[model samples]
Target: MTIVAEPQFHVLAVDDSIIDRKLIERLLKTSSFQVTTVDSGSKALEFLGLVEQEEEEQQQQQTSSTSGLSSYHQEIEVNLVITDYCMPGMTGYDLLKKIKESSSLKNIPVIIMSSENAPSRISRCLEEGADEFLLKPVKLSDMKKLRPHILKGKCKDQQKQHQKITCSIDITAAPSPTLVAGSASKRKSMEDDTLAPQRTRARFSSETLTVII
Candidate 1:
């Protein structure tokens, strides 16, 4: 029997702060996720194997052009993208919007981390399709919330397998030929009893018969 290997989830971490990048890297590695840390959104997109500015440029030139840029990121599939909300050149929100707009990359989950606890900012991130918003200096506990979203994909795959198995069992669990035939025979017998001609009792003429009179 071949042993199936479990997939290791890879995460992309983006931050302009060097210290925070190191911290996030260590925490993610400790949690057993394959981690890649980048200094900016441009590098993060580069790590994802996306062509810089070209994808956006192409989209602007041709509204419906689907495929032109090559993704180096496809080699190691990234299950999640976690980025700092505030960066110098391109902000996390900008990156999130780019990822979401990309037809090829939009499915990846994006989590935003910010030092600011502004409710309006958080609401904006959520509205922009950020999966989770984490307060800056993320903790191990916050990492726990990250797993469920990645595992959701696995759960859906398992559910599909379960449905297939259930359908097979239902098909196999059907009544046997003998049992089916017996039921059919019983039904026919009942139908014959209900529809068969009934015999009536013959009535004798008491005093009205000529011979008797």
Candidate 2:
């Protein structure tokens, strides 16, 4: 039997410098990410929106072709976004803010790569919710550090979705003679138990536990 590897994750890279954009694109391609490079922030935004629309249309076509069942195949998966902070018309900050505000695009992780190493600039990017920041002349080793965090975030999101499905199953799988007999009470108790913290410890919990143990 022949096994095929899954499609690589996509990353949209935006930068004004031709050399910088090409460098980032090459780096991402070698690292297993399918990179799409755009010269300016405005072009990046246009490409993003266009790609989303095309995906939706493709999904609709696929559904109609079958018995209205949604297809599992993904044409493109844009899981991460990397952009330079200094662009002409729309700066990286502006693009980041736009992405954060859009409901459809807000969940995509964004990394700000820039040469501006000033404290204020870096602080502002963090404050505006950039997931990762890299100084200009990015190193391959530095890019590797961000992979774990990005993967962790993806795992957490999957876990949350699984939890929701499990809760729904539990609620619907009530085994009782009476239709309404233990359902509501069981749900309430479950809700409370779910909300309760798993552990309780003092302020210096780790240190105290280490010393006592």
| Highest-TM-score candidate | 1
Q: Write the per-residue lDDT of candidate 1 for residues 120-208, one digit (tens) a residue.
A: 99999899889899998798658766766665543443464464422221222334211111113323433343234441111111111
Worst 10 residues of 1 by lDDT: 204-213
Regions of model 2 farther than 4 Å from truth: 1-7, 50-75, 163-213
- Clashing residue pairs found in predicted model 1: 49-72, 49-73
- TM-score of every model? 0.63, 0.60
Which portions of model 1 miss their true places by more than 4 Å? 1-4, 52-73, 153-213
Q: What is the lDDT of residue 186 in candidate 1?
A: 24
What lDDT tens digits, residue by residue, belong to model 2 across residues 1-213? 211122345688899999998899877754546689988877776665523444656655554211122335333556677999988899999899877765455667889998978889888988888988899997654555444444544555457456442221222233321111112332353334323453111111111111111
